[model samples]
Each structure stands twice: as C-alpha cells, then as structure tokens.
Target: MATASETKATRRDFLYVATGAVGAVGVAGVAWPLIDQLNPDASVLALASIRFDIAPIVEGSSVTILWRGLPVFIRHRTEAEIEEARAVPMADLKDPQRDEDRVVEGHDQWLIMIANCTHLGCVPVGEAGDFDGWFCPCHGSHYDTSGRIRRGPAPANLVVPPYEFISDTVVQIG
Candidate 1:
C-alpha cells in the first residue's frame, strides 16, 4: 500500500486538523478579554463584601446602611423589643420564623435584615408598625421585630443577607 496519492491525502488531512486547532485557539485568546471585562469592576467588588462597626450604634436604636444597593437595617434591640419578639406565638405569624433562627447565636442583642419589604420591595419604616417592627406604607405590610410578616399582604419574612461577625464589634456582610 505504498501509494503516493494516499500519502498526500493523509498529509493534507493532518495539516487541516492542525490549522483548525490553531485557529480555534487564536479565536479563544481574542474572545477571553471581551468576556472577562463584562464582570464587575473593583468598585463593585468592594461593595460586595463590607465590614460594618456596630459599636457606634446605641441600644434601642438602629442604623441603615447600603449593601449591594440594598438598604440593610442594623438594630441594637432593647430588652423589651427582644422580649416582644420572643413572646409572640408561632401560630400568629403569617410567615412563621423563630426569633432565634433569624439571628446568629451568642449575638442576641444585634438584629440585621434587608430593609426592603417582602410585599413590593418598598422600604419599611422600622419600630413604628402595629407589632413595633416595620411597616411598609406602600402596601400596609406589617413585619414583627424578628422580621417575620405578622399581618397584611407580605408573603414572606424580610430577607436576611449572608453575614457574620468578623470581630466583637465588626460585622462582615455580603
């Protein structure tokens, strides 16, 4: 089977495959930067995870901060507020969640939640509702002190963003 034409054809096929592979690699190299640039830049990335100090926040008072373009409520709950949240029966809640379940253990005094109301994404006013939690003026949604929907139109509890205490007074939220 020592045919010159067959040998030429085999060589031609090998060249075609090699050319195709090289072309594919070239195309990938050109496209990579275009794809990677679409990702979030440094400023956006910096906002993705932030460390907040809770030391300045007074007991029975709360502060609101922006995280990933969402308003987040960081509350230093008073003893009465904590007691009120814990005393409510699970049966009375529209979206029943235990008070302890919403907060990290050993950090009972601090309560954090995304301030947007679950009903229509409206910012709820804190410590002013029927349950003394949060009330969405847009839809009359009432959230309890534990951020559980106690009444009105909301179907779920206020969202709890991913967060942890990095130090005694510093909290890292993402």
Candidate 2:
C-alpha cells in the first residue's frame, strides 16, 4: 500500500474510471436531443390541449371549434333543452347516456361533443334534429339534446372529449 508503483497504478485506475464516467455522460448528453426530437412538434403539442372562452356563446346556441383535426361542438344549453334532455327515459335511448352523465356536474348547461356522426363522418346539423339535438342528414341519425343517439344509423352517442371548466367562462378541452 505504500509503494510508489502501486500508488501510480491505483491513480491510473481511478483516472480510467473517471474518464469512462465522463464519456458515458457525454454520450448521454449527445443522445438526449436526438431522442427528444422524435417527439411531436411544438405545433402538434399545442393542439393537444386548448383553453377556450365560452362566455360569448348564449343559451341555446353553440359553436364549433377544431380540436386535434376534428370538429368539436360546444353548446350552451337553454333551460328548456336541459329539461328535455333530463326528462328522457333511459329505455328510449339508442345510446343510453344520461344528460347528467354527459355533462360536467355543476356545469350542466354546457354540452361538448365531437360533431361528426357516429355512423359516418358527416357533421350534424345543430338545432335541426327530431329530438332537438343534432341531425346527420347523410344517414338520418338523430341525436338528443344530450347528444345521445336516438334514431337512425348512428350506432352510438356523439363522443364527449375530455374537458374541464377552467373558470366560470373558460373550458379546457383535450
């Protein structure tokens, strides 16, 4: 342990280990950017989630916004619409989703769903369906005020996107 040659060998071993550690760190540093670049672009990531001001929409009115390359319908339901939606029996629905279940608990007046018809990709005509929800004229699919499939070719209800009320007037959808 006290010999000069032994001390030199120990120092050389430590230097080799230290250099190898640094080289591993350097390789990782070089590879990090390459790996991260493979992820989605900034613009694509920005479209993954969006916050929208819903205050401008009045009762019984709705607006369509693009989300992740799909048309998302955001409806501000009137009291009558909400009542009608709530009154429907579960047995009468083609796609049995409750009005209360389709909307956020406290914000029952807001209904957000994907606008495309379930049977086909046609956009439904709002406020024009048999049940006062949306009508897809392409295949005669009728949705209820709760966006539940009521009649015709659509096999299921309009898809509800993942969303939350950010504030009283703002909603974040993804």
Candidate 3:
C-alpha cells in the first residue's frame, strides 16, 4: 500500500542504518587490539609493586629479590659500612651522590639498589668489589657501599628503585 517515493525513502534509510552498523563494527575490530595492547600483561602488572619485610635481614648482609625480571638488592648495612660510605668526599664519587641521599632519614642502615652492574647488566657479587659494595666479575666494575660507581668501566651508579617504608620493619618497592 505504500507509494513509490515512500518505498524509496524507506530503502534509503535502511541502507544508511546498515552501513553505519557495519562501519562501527569495522572500526571496533581495528580499535580493540590497539586498546588491549596498551594494557599491561599479567606478569608485568604483578611486578608493578612489591612489599618486603626487613626484620629478618641482619646487619652487614644482603638479600636479593626479583622485581620486573631483575634482581633487587636489599642490604642491612653495619654501622662501620655506613660510616665508611659517609666518610667518602663527594669529589671522589663518579656519580657524586651523598650517602645520606641514598638512604631514608630515620633508617640509614638499609641500602636498596638494583643488583645489575651498570656496565653490561651482569649481576654483581655483594661485598666483593674494591669499594666493598658490589663487584661485577664479568666486566670488573666496582660499586661503593652507597651503590655509587667507584672503579672500572661502569658509567653510572647502580639504579635505585622507587620505594617507601610501609612500617618500621616493612618497605614497598616499585
């Protein structure tokens, strides 16, 4: 019972609606993967932060923990080590960072640094370098007690990760 112009207009409206739906689907097909890729994978998301208990780490010893596929060193420095780090003049350092700057105000005994050697990503041996901090056996780089680069081929100091004390004996790192 519809007239000729009415039939043509209805067909045109249907075509427009159908075209819009298909275009939207096509756009979504292309955009979904890109949006999903921006999100972090499960393992990486898991490493976004880590909580550590410092109570069991005795003085003058270090513990290694995995964070974002890298080893992080948590050292409980002895009083002598703290004194030795503090005594070094700023001019002697390759990176020129003060010992107090590297540690928290109330808790100067805890030293936290990323465990890889800055020279070539090799793991450093704790308390073995010329500076009595960490030594990279692979390339002979030395780090001091404050994780400052002291000798050999490394261009910079060991990296310090973002961290905070959650409690007197607990620390959170990211």
Candidate 4:
C-alpha cells in the first residue's frame, strides 16, 4: 500500500496533467484565429466593392469570381445564347420569369448568378451544351443559362446578388 505522501504526489501529478491539457487547448483556440488573420486571402474582414475588368471574357464565355466569400458567375452571352435562354418556355421552368428576375434594365445577354446550388450550397460547373446550364455534381441540380432552375433537386433558382455595371467592360459584383 502507498503512504499518504505518495497518494498526495500522484493526485498532484494528475492535476498538473489535466491543467496542462486544458492550457494547451486554450492556447490553440486563441492562436487559430490569429493565424487565420495573418493569411493574405482571409475573408474574416468585410470585403469592399471591387471592380472587375471583364474585357477578357469572350462574347460566349463565362467567368467566376470570389466575392464576399461567395462564387459569382458572370457570363457574357452571345446573341444566340441569349435567344436560346429566351426561347426556353416559361411552362418548362420551375420558377417562371417575372420582370424582377431580369438583372439589367433592358439587357438579356449578360447573365449573372451566384454559382451555388440552392439545394445544398455546392458550386455547379458551367456545362455549355444542350443542357446549357450549371450542373452541380453533388446532387445533380441543374440551372439554366439565366440561372433559373431547370431540373434536378434544387428547390429555387440560383441567386443573383445585387450588382451593377461600372462600364461596358467593368462590373461591380457585391
């Protein structure tokens, strides 16, 4: 059997070990936010309005940008693609077009959408074909060129955030 002194020593050692473990966890918790702040591309800080030079986007091409920690899709639609989107019957769309759905006042060629699937928040890849839309491989959600939900399991249209055109070649997506 151990003496009283030995029993006291063992209890003290266990206490020290528990205290050290808690201290290490606390230090790590505090250090993680500091380390993340030091990262160059950290999004903890609020993003200011940014202007994108879109001259490189061809008439039929689309580009993706990270804005406020969300993927923004900016597609420069050709006249043919714009007509194709317009040709999609409202009866076929899950959410029929209203005047508010149109992003620009008088243009239907520039298609902008938040590149996130409405069902599960996955980024969808732009598939330019007969299924000319964004396809989410996660759960097979599909969005038309106008960001309207065409098929699959997504419940709503791809979001179109508040944005404005700074110029014919510059767009400010907030």
Q: Model 1, range 65-156, lDDT digits (tens) per residue?
A: 99999999999999898899999999998888899988889998899999999888999999888999999999999888888998889999
Candidates ranked by TM-score: 1, 2, 3, 4
**Local error of candidate 2 at residue 3 (angstroms):** 21
Clashing pairs in 3: none
Clashes of each: 0, 0, 0, 0
Best by lDDT: 2
Q: Give the 10-residue window scoring lowest on summed lDDT in candidate 1.
A: 1-10
Residue pairs in collision within model 2: none
What TM-score should be assigned to candidate 1? 0.86
**Model 1 pairs in collision:** none
Q: How far is 92's C-alpha from truth in model 3 (Å)?
A: 0.8
Each model's lDDT: 0.92, 0.94, 0.92, 0.78
> Who is ahead in lDDT, 2 or 3?
2
The candidate with the higher lDDT, 2 or 4, is 2
lDDT of 3 by residue, 1-174 (tens): 976653446788989999999999999999999999999999888889999999999888999998888899999999999999999998988888899988888989999999989889999999997889999999899899889999989899899888899998999998
How well does candidate 4 match the true structure in TM-score terms? Answer: 0.68
State the local distance difference test value for candidate 1: 0.92
Model 4 residue 46 CA deviation (Å) reads: 5.2
Q: Residue 96 of model 3: what lDDT?
A: 89
Q: Could you tell me which 10 consecutive residues in candidate 3 have the lowest summed lDDT?
A: 2-11
Per-model TM values vs. the true structure: 0.86, 0.84, 0.82, 0.68
Candidate with more favorable, higher TM-score: 2 or 4:
2
